[model samples]
Target: MLFDKIARPAMYRLAYHDPEVVHERTVRLLGRVAPALGPVSRVYRTDDPVTVLGLRFPNRVGLAAGMDKNGLALKAWPALGFGFVEVGTVTRHAQPGNPKPRLFSLPGSDGVINRMGFNNDGAEALARRLAAHGKPGVPLGISIGKSKVTPLDEAVEDYRFSLRALHPYADYFAINVSSPNTPGLRALQDKAALAELLAELGRTSAELGGSTPLLVKVAPDLTEEALAELVEVCLGHGVAGIIATNTTLSREGIAPADAHLAAEIGGLSGRPLAARSLEVVKFVHECTEGKLPIIGVGGILGPDDARRMLDAGASLVQLYTGFALHGPGLVRRVSRGIAGRPC
Candidate 1:
């Protein structure tokens, strides 16, 4: 209540509504206070444990990739009751990413539009940070993407480099080929391209002792045919799971007051994304006949949204824009909701 009523509002107002500013400040604060967050663990943690991809999750809800891109506050996420924390969309090389004013907040519609690209300190930096910080209590998923400077054809090697750098620390690797912000990134989702990518990743994972689970994050804009083909490729290539539906390129559900922001270029995430994401999860589930595990994401803003994702055959779910807007209270609510405990 205090976070939604006061802190959230104040954070939104910071730096004249520059979303990245609030994001940076929040991550830094969480890192600083992580050591003293025992009370947070006690109050927010919900235990409805399950094992997926050979990794045990303390709950169904997890902090999604791109939220803590560099693993800055690794310790604080478990304290906040997330079943797991996925960090990075980090690439092989460090680059500044797009330009300033690249992230927009749509409060009225409960959405965010970002073309931030795959901005990060690179996988090597993240590997060092994880090493120094030690692993967090919850499972860690590292999302890797091709460097902006890397050509489309060479994407496999770029992603492979990061996987090698971070392999020892991650519980899983989410091959990020669907973020719309990076030019030519989503093209890698095509059947042939994805097949090549996953094949190389499989061999590389084998070289690294073959223990880390590899999953793919997909876009919400794919057609049913495209999605079906993608699933077939995943099944054929030995991919462990799929994170159904990353942010969407559509602007159909924005509020009237925020109509102008809808014209912004980038993937859209939040409430407007709920229906499409759910549909994709259901489609993937039915298409695979429940053989493949799915980490459902996008548009999960509350407990009901999380519940619906689970009902749609998602083995697990993750939070991004929802946690950004609602704070840790939302985590506790969704955790308790999934565990059948009263919130």
Candidate 2:
């Protein structure tokens, strides 16, 4: 409540100046201090234990990818009340990503638009950091992506390299092929490409014998036919689960006051994404007859949104733009709500 009423407004004012600056500073500050303040900065902890993808999550709410691209503030997340934290979208090689002003806030619609292009310090860096600091209190899922310089034909080897490097650290792996910012990245989501990629990754996991669950993060922009094909490919390749509905390229619900910002090319997330993301989750859940677990993400802003996602058959829910907007308090609220609800 304090965050929504007081701190959030102050942050909004700062956001008007430079959102990325505030973001980087916050992550860095938290990265440096969170481990030390671990016991003191803690919030609500729910015992609503549920196992998905062969791992137990303390609660349903998790910190989504992109917020901690390089895992800098990893230890801070569980203290802030996230049941789990998915880090990176890290690539094989370090890259600066797109030019500045790549991240934008649409205050009017309570949304964010970003074309960050998977900017990070690379997978080996993250693995080394995790090795030094250790994993957070909760489950840590590592999301891996293709590097910009890597050709489409060699994407398999590219992803394989990162997976091999970070394999020891990740509790689970999220294969990201959804972000619109990366050119030709989404092409990997196609049937043949997806099949080949997952088959090799599946083989890699088998070779490791770790049984680390592999979940694919998909875009909300795919057609029904395309999604069905992707689902089939996942099953064929032995994928453990799916992280349905990454950011959307569609600007359908941007508030008119913020419609001008819609012209900026990137994936749009937050409230506008709630409906479509939920739709995709429900479709996937129904199609799979709830056999495959789904990590619901995209537009969740509060407990109600999280509830709707869970009710729609998502086994878990993740927050990104919503967390950036409402602060960590939102995690407690959502967790409590899910905990108190009848199953």
lDDT of 2 at 222: 94
TM-scores, each model vs. reference: 0.98, 0.97
* Model 1 regions more than 4 Å off: 340-343
Q: For candidate 1, write residues 1-343 as lDDT tens digits.
A: 7889999988888735588989988999999999999987999999998888998888889999988898899999999999999998899998888998888889898888989898899999999998887989889999999999999999999999999999999999999999998899999999999999999999999999999999999899999899999999999999999998899999989999789898889989999999999999999999999999999998998889988998998999999999999899999998888884221
- RMSD (Å) per prediction: 1.7, 1.3
TM-score of candidate 1 relative to the true fold: 0.98
Clashing pairs in 2: none
lDDT of 2 by residue, 196-302 (tens): 99999988888888589999999999999999999989888888899988999999889998988999999999999999999999999988888889999988888
lDDT score of residue 227 within candidate 2: 95
